[model samples]
Target: MAPKAAVLVPCLLSLLLPFSSLALTQDICVANLLLPDTPSGYPCKPKPAVTADDFHSMALAQAGPTLAPFNTGLATATVKQFPGVNGLGLAATRVDVHVGGVVPLHSHPEGSELLFVFKGSMTAGFISAESNEVYVKEVREGELFVFPQGLLHFQYNTGNETAVGFAAYSSDNPGLQITDYALFGNTLTAEDAREQGHLRRKIGGDEAQGLLRIAEILKLIKVFFGLSAVPPDGRQDYRCSLLWTCGV
Candidate 1:
């Protein structure tokens, strides 16, 4: 009788686990784009206001322009662009890189990224935070690679043809922090930029000095053009010259 009681209790708990999980995830919170966003996500739209259009976007089906310099184009579908994914904790980007092009060094502060390659080939890598070691691989079509959260990573198109890939992030708004732009294109003081952005550790002394000079020049350019120091999306614009010169 005692053995039967133990078996029955274990079986009952196992049966209830799925129901408990389902209950937690059963309801979907569609995003209300007009409302102010909170730390967790945007406020949920009223159920009556929600429509099927909230769940789709034609933007992801088209390819972005791949021009000179970096020769890489990225089309992102985030909560801001696709409100349907609001509070869903997931978003995606379509990346197209021409031969000899690179996605550059960048990090996502809020999410991990999983890259799925569907065309051509590329070399992708990320720096490990625990060991500070670089983990790199040559990935081809039908392969996938992962860049862990908050780690600096990059992808380069190594093949002669174009490379196409999709990156899925763990957050609806995965903040993109490009290494060069963060170091040289923001409102930070030169000293603060160097210290906080780790510019000294990443580049040569001459290069760092050049970047500082360029940053100063860009500040003047912004003032001359009457552009806001920070854009509505909270990211400072990278100067056209900087983008062309750095190939980022």
Candidate 2:
């Protein structure tokens, strides 16, 4: 009888474990931004201190200031700015592009993005990672587009006036890397770039054309960041060499 009772007790405990776990689950975990974040997300605010205001934010209500070269502004509502989205796996950004402006090549490593146009029009595109083929479309007011995770993409204002769009991400804190800034805005030495260039050519080919485009991009980055511009003589090798050595 004792042996039979022990086995039955174990079975009953196993059956009740799920209910105990569910009882421990939380309804919401509004972020406690004052604390350091973890791999999963910011720690939850104390229930006593959490409030309705934590879930509401005006961070994206107004157009952020535009900057030169890109003539673009961004207002983001991520966990850091909005506190309520931590561990929620969602965030938003407002993009405003003036006439003739562009949001340059960039990628979000952590999340897929969806853009909804609310005003004016813009041309948007993302490069296919598997085939390297470019896919583009002109999105106007009330239209939308999706960019898959970690793909290089861009948006350009194609209309006569300002273009405004709201972008949402599948992550509470979508990581961002602008291609030009990642490449030319760093402290990497010219030798490091040269070594990496060899591998790039072996994989993609057309090293010469790639170098030309790189030089042009470097010049634009330098000018945009208020650094000295590359010489206008346009000698590809000379321009690239000087720009690299000067750490542009």
Task: Provide the global lDDT of candidate 1 against the true structure.
Answer: 0.76
Please list the C-alpha lDDT of all candidates, in the order they appear: 0.76, 0.79
Question: Model 1 segments beyond 4 Å from truth?
Answer: 1-26, 189-248
**Could you give candidate 2's per-residue lDDT for residues 5-30 as a string of tens digits?**
99999999889665442112577888
Model 2, residue 58: distance off in Å is 0.6
Best-fitting candidate, measured by TM-score? Answer: 2
The candidate scoring highest on lDDT is 2
lDDT of 1 by residue, 73-130 (tens): 8888988888888766789999998877788789999999999998998899999989
**lDDT (Cα, 0-100) at 35 in candidate 1:** 83
Model 1 poorest 10 in a row by lDDT: 239-248
